[model samples]
Target: MEEVEVVVAHSERATLRVGEVFLKVDADQSRIDVEVEAMSLAPVPTPKVLWRKPPVLAIAALPGATLGRLGGPSTGSPAAWAAAGAAIRKLHDAPLPPRTGRAGRSIVALAAELDAECEALVANGVLPGDLVTRNRQVAEAALRPWTPVFTHGDLQIAHVFVDAGEVTGIIDWSEAGRGDALYDLATFTLGHEEHLDDVIGGYGTDLDLDLDVIHGWWSLRSLLAVRWLIEHGFDPFAPGCEVDVLRARM
Candidate 1:
């Protein structure tokens, strides 16, 4: 019998690995719908949909290893990172999806939310006030206007898979939709600033990307993530994690 490996388990969702298939159990059907639809629409490589049984969506695992994990050394070379960036560029150039996603949220709403989260991070003594304020200032750069494109809203390193310096697949499409292209850039390169240049080399200069905005998203994401991470049993402050990313700014 194949051992059921728990990939991730949280209140909102859980994923179990059974041999070559990954079974995703999400309470929100809409997210599953989005994942399925986005995979179909995406121009880049995506996991094969094995089947869908209501709360459980089974997908064939990609053959390549993940690009990297947060708070860990990246096994991918600069070429592999560039390939991932190229893939992202292709995804962004694709036609927009019907529904809005994380990157599609209104700037005003996001700003308000960031403010509230910053306050909470300080009040709850999660992060130093100075650290929060500095990053909050940096986060402001990303609040400005941007052209929306199809985006993998959560393009974390772990979501991307690579082999032989080429992108094999990208996963976790529930947060995928039309949104700011830079948000995807920032999210993918979040903690791994060292490879930002290689990624941009493949992504091209057409994005008119402002480094500050990338840094802002870094801060904005970290501040917003601290509470949720703690509550969900994740350690944002772990070395090379969210807190370290924030501290690197100061």
Candidate 2:
């Protein structure tokens, strides 16, 4: 391992080395740095949400190679999905700090938030086809009584890292929140249909995931992706064809 001193302070963003490892540095007083070993696989990039942090100053240790590759999904396969699901279940079972504040009164409030996000997308000249309406209905329905569990908020193949068919760790915890457990299921299913059964099976009845709730989360996530694309100058309509198809079904 090579040790280097910080000449200039950058940001607290995580950096990765392609097919190697990931390094996350904190800008706080301690200047804590975390390094996670990368599994020997990559995931396919689908529409997914990721947390954002400050930038990092890149110091090249190896010649002609970048520090890490930003964006994109892991090489999530059936085994990888199974591993990810297992990891997720373990995380859910772990103790979490108590949640505070009235984030939402009920499903209605959650639905309202989804609606507002969709409306804002449209108002900003981004046409998400029928994703907004579809998501609203799903959100309202999913708000019914269900076991509340910790959610990665953006749980998807992209956010998952795998090596040797085992999930080493999960990345991008910025959107971590408390919500319906099904939300994570939805995210996994929508992006990794082939591994849907495996992921659900891994959940192992610890929590009952309603199909409606999963569908609702799928719609909400799709809309969020489209909105992001629009804002970032990516062709939302073209890249979000799957979301459009789901909207049509709705």
- Would you estimate the TM-scores of all the predictions? 0.98, 0.63
Best by TM-score: 1
lDDT of model 1 at position 50? 94
- Among all windows of ten consecutive residues in candidate 2, which has the lowest summed lDDT? 33-42
- Tell me how far the alpha carbon of residue 199 in candidate 2 is from the true structure, in angstroms, after superposition: 0.9
Distance from true position, residue 127, model 1, in Å? 1.1
Pairs of colliding residues, candidate 2: 16-68, 39-163, 42-74, 42-75, 43-73, 43-74, 43-75, 73-158
Candidate 2 structure quality by residue, lDDT tens digits, 138-223 = 65655677555555555655556566666645654434445556766776566445456777776676566666667666666666
